[model samples]
Target: MQMLPLNMAAVTTVAMWKAIALIGLAVAEAFVVVSSSPRERSVSTQLASEYGASARTRTRDDYIDINRESGGPIVRYDGPTIRPLSNVRAPSLDEIWESTMPVIVQGGSLRTWSFANPQVDAVQVLFKSEGRPIDADIDLWNGPDNTPHKMRVYVEDGARRTFSAIIGTPRGPNSIAVRNIGQLEFPLDAVVRPDMQDGLAASIASVVSKAEVIQGGSVRTWSFNPVVQSVAVIIKTDGRPLNSRIELLMGPNNSKQVVEIYTEDGVERPFFAIVETPEAVGSVIRIKNTAPLEFPVYASVAPYTLGEYNFVGDSNSFNEWHML
Candidate 1:
């Protein structure tokens, strides 16, 4: 038999090393399964024992080591004010007579709303071309007080957004309508006191992302509330194609940092994909329309479906998901 070349011998040695490593890993895994309580030995346990050497765990306080093998985001809820929208059973926001902010235009003025004890989340202000004036559910995050919230009017379709600068300065009913949004419940401090003339302690903060809006849905929504201090949705469609803009509200609506996306058509299709879950802080928004119509509200809230999710976080009041 011809002897192997020098280079070939080196290659053989490397391959042997790799093979040995793989075998070692397999053996470790088996040992873990064999060592664990027979009843407790599961696929997860076996894999963990074999490759993922137990980090450390002691009976005392410092003895317990957090094994982070999942390599996913560390889901945490430590915010002071946080909760779900349904906790307080908010009166489904159908109509709101908000006090619009004062604005000096070409000839008239508009008073933007300052709701009493303004508890709003998934809140919006939508306008109807045919029905009574629409309401825009503008989510207001926490921020410095006395800031102005503004929206330029126009038409939109699909992944496109257009704004028609009102010929010159904007005006009345013909002008775009503005109102405070309300969903399952009023968010923390989103309400104004009966005594205070303007928005109470509720200053705008960072708004959550503009949830997925594929099929023709447009409206402002937040991931959490301040009062109920939880999470919820507030969606309003104008029949035409729409794109959801995730607005991060900065102090008194001083302005908005916006992020947007379209939704999957609920009528004919359902976008199905098991998106690898990021850290726990990330929100997994699955907007599925169970009904055929789209107007006032959306289908039932999730979690209740699999009888898993829909619970307050262990630490805070924000919404928490459960896998069934």
Candidate 2:
């Protein structure tokens, strides 16, 4: 055999090693691709378990450790990125209502609370609005003792608020009067008493009457003698177009309190009529469907005397405040 130069022989040896290394790398890449498949990974996992490796393989192309702890397979992350937890706290009902204090209008001449106690002349006014804040004159004169007491207070609106105000004693019956001082009308609620918040002592509402569907051009009537003062009348269109009239008759004279509801968009909206009766006498709820269509109606009258509070509702002008 003819001998080659020593440098050339060394170069040839280096080239042979490089070619082997490249071939090995290509084989390794091909094995990776094949093992990454679901079927191949499953088979590999089964074989690993049979051989005492107990390897766990996932469907996704995850970077997993094998024989990591000598007992079980390690799980690696190959899915979507996980999000960190948030630390911000949401506002409570009381905090949210406090923030609704009228920006431009500091206070109003509107008298919000009126009470006539033989011992106390002024009591705390706990007020809340179902919708946005309403600027209204509350005519609290509901009885013989309720002298002409009218006050304008910025009734903070939203959620079930129990904010208190120090105003003259609320007048009339437990039920008060609300008139929209602003051009627009909104649902308003108020509780009058001292040393408490709304619903802190109020009883959980009990269902006096179940839901009933009233046909078009018909009337559904319910009568009950309330032992307490507060009565909640709920009317819903059930997502159907509705134009109806709701009447709450109470007192000896049978004073008719009417609410005309018309849902133009056919949205399933429940209109609440919180009726503060003049007395715990005989009360009647009469719903008449003025529209020529069928609609569902429900009413629950809970007559509970909140120990330290007078749970009252607006008697007149629900037209201005019925968009609950």
Minimal lDDT window, size 10, model 1: 162-171
Name the lDDT of candidate 1: 0.28
- How do the residues 211-264 of candidate 1 rate in per-residue lDDT, one tens digit apiece? 344343434223312222222233333333223333333244422223232332
Over 4 Å off, model 1 = 1-52, 56-206, 209-211, 216-229, 239-286, 290-324
**Candidate 2, 219-271: lDDT as tens digits:** 87766432323354555555665566666565443534445555432332334
Local distance difference test scores for all models: 0.28, 0.43
Best by TM-score, which number?
A: 2
Query: On a 0 to 100 scale, what is the lDDT of residue 154 in model 1?
Result: 21
Each prediction's RMSD over C-alphas, in Å, is 22.6, 23.3
Each candidate structure's TM-score, on Cα atoms with residue i matched to residue i, is 0.20, 0.32
lDDT of 2 at 318: 20
Evaluate model 2: give its lDDT: 0.43
